[model samples]
Target: REDPSDAIVLKSGLHLDKPLDILFDTKAGTIGTSSLRRIAQLKQLNPEIKIQDVRGNLNTRLAKLDDKNGDYSALILASAGLKRSDFNGRISHQLRDNWYYAVGQGALAIETRVGDTFTLDLLKPLIDLKTTYECLAERTFMQQLEGGCSVPIGVHTSWNNDNQSLLTLEGIVLSLDGRTKVQNKMTIDLNERLVNANIDDSSCPFNYTDIAINQMSDHIVVNKLRNSAILGYELAQSLTELGAKRILDAIKRQ
Candidate 1:
């Protein structure tokens, strides 16, 4: 974050290559939204996945997934968690890559006081500009759509294959049952989006006067970030125009 609150968000990371012949999970709150989206997506290609509310930490859950007598076929999990705990090798029959994860899924975040220069200075060097941009765009989409656990929105952000400077955002809205789908994507030249932009003092909404923009180099970083956020907004607009709102609204009503 240019200022504070969110210096990071869940990011996609390595996961086990575990095969997906079954489905189960350690139930939780907001994170479960991603699980719902996963189940909704995977059910389309495989037989119905078993959804159960297992209680436990990563260890307990994996134990259940590995229990020989257990009926669990698969356990929905954050690949980042698996990787962080050094259990990525346990993953199999992956579903993460075959479809978009939720906005900001698996992201890592660092939080600090709004004007804490000391903390900001210490953390600034750790920020990855590309990952920062990607998270910002995804956060923007989720924010614009007003999507939550009930709506089950999906999004993916990546750099262009041919040109490293270009970024593309793909968003999908799926019914809880996975029968209905509305998807759209937008690509932008990350460097080009700012050419005609009004780069004034008001350019970056999250501008940290003392930290992020004190130097010209930091100013440019925030500028690129501001433009990346707009990509999410623009993509949300495109999605709404294509009846994504209707799909979400209907899901909400249910």
Candidate 2:
């Protein structure tokens, strides 16, 4: 789990698929925006579902859900939590495909003080290169849109199962009311990454830096991460072009 750098994805997939009735996030201080998009999406298809505020740990919420007289018919939760709590048996159904989750939802991070070369080098051996790149892209997308825990932004990022360098990112921006949304997606093949190494730094700027030679990382690895970030930036721009900005603006006013 030691991957040297300021930050690296420990692992993602910490999210549940769709089919969650509420956007239940106990870890984050911001759950309002998280619920609107999915709740709206699911409710449109199943109007019988209603949202209620329930506060407690995982098992407590489950108890409320099980209460016959309680208002909750179902409660949405992360499968990861269920497994971690040894309550995997409680997972009746999981929504996986086409589920948009909070940005960086399922991703874990190993953070180090910037420029800590010794520690960074120590972590190189354990890095999952593919997952790290995927997170770079996802995080870049969130940052580009100024998204955070409080923003009603949802995203899904994945690398091709067969081709790790082929990345797909899908994102959504929802108004606070969940009545309006703008979504878009994009793909990037890191294989198409810039090949010329001697190019001027100003012409092709990147957030990627100093992993290979300086930190005992592959020089090419830095570029791959940069490409992943570029994919995110472009996707955010595309979503904005599709009116995501308006939705976000309205949300900010709220």
Candidate 3:
């Protein structure tokens, strides 16, 4: 289904007043945030439910659910990964817009150690500004929450370049049972900075294209993005602290 339509369907299925949880793969990245929030809410009401973890590769993970002896009540995987692995049939649950995909889960990254002038120069031109900013915000959010790929969280970001660089990020946290949820959004200005000296389009050691290279350095913009993501994370934390923990405790008792 189209993203908007899919979002509608997923949103309609959520029970924000109840506690629910989700399990996702590490490769699926940051989509688990929303899942955790939703599930937490459900736990607040029942306080006797259970949310746990299960792991495996794509097909193997799905197979566990079908096995009669398997303990999982549901499975969560990236829409992209499912499509890539040709396992769309396994996605019994698709989250709503508030609980959308993370920044770069389906994308690839090329990182070089700091001070590696050669690799830095080689990889600079290959960077996509939009992708870079979105991923930066999402990763920052994950880091601030001290959450890993296994958490029930999700983040989706957008950029507006009309005047200043403005980024909008939507985030979600869910409980394990997929019953409770919480979501929030934040925006930031992308300040410009000088480009890294090591990054150039010259046909030197690493030949690359200079596509959408902003005159402003991505460093400052990335920092702002990180802060924005943290803002969303803090909001989620508040919700978790106030009500989500209760739900989790109740679920554990069950």
Model 2 CA deviation exceeding 4 Å by range? 1-34, 43-48, 194-217
Across residues 95-154, which tens digit of lDDT does each residue of candidate 2 receive? Answer: 656567655555455667756768767877766676666666777777778777667777
Candidate 2 vs candidate 3, lDDT winner: 2
Give me the overall lDDT of model 2.
0.59
Deviating ranges (above 4 Å) for candidate 1:
1-34, 194-217
Ranking by TM-score: 1, 2, 3
User: Which parts of model 3 are misplaced by more than 4 Å?
Assistant: 1-52, 68-73, 100-104, 145-154, 159-165, 172-183, 189-254
Pick the TM-score winner.
1
Clash count per candidate: 18, 5, 53
Tens-digit per-residue lDDT, 15-112, candidate 1: 32433322322221111123566656655544354455556887877676556565554556666666677876654534544477766666666766
Write down the lDDT of every candidate, Cα atoms only.
0.60, 0.59, 0.48
Estimate TM-scores for all models.
0.76, 0.74, 0.51
- Which 10-residue window in model 1 sums to the lowest lDDT? 2-11
Choose 1 or 3, whichever is better by TM-score: 1
What lDDT is obtained when candidate 1 is compared to the true structure? 0.60
lDDT agreement of model 3 with the native: 0.48
- Least accurate 10 contiguous residues by lDDT in model 3: 1-10
**Model 3 per-residue lDDT tens digits across residues 80-165:** 66666666544555655334564456655665554466776666777665565555556555554555555556666666668547
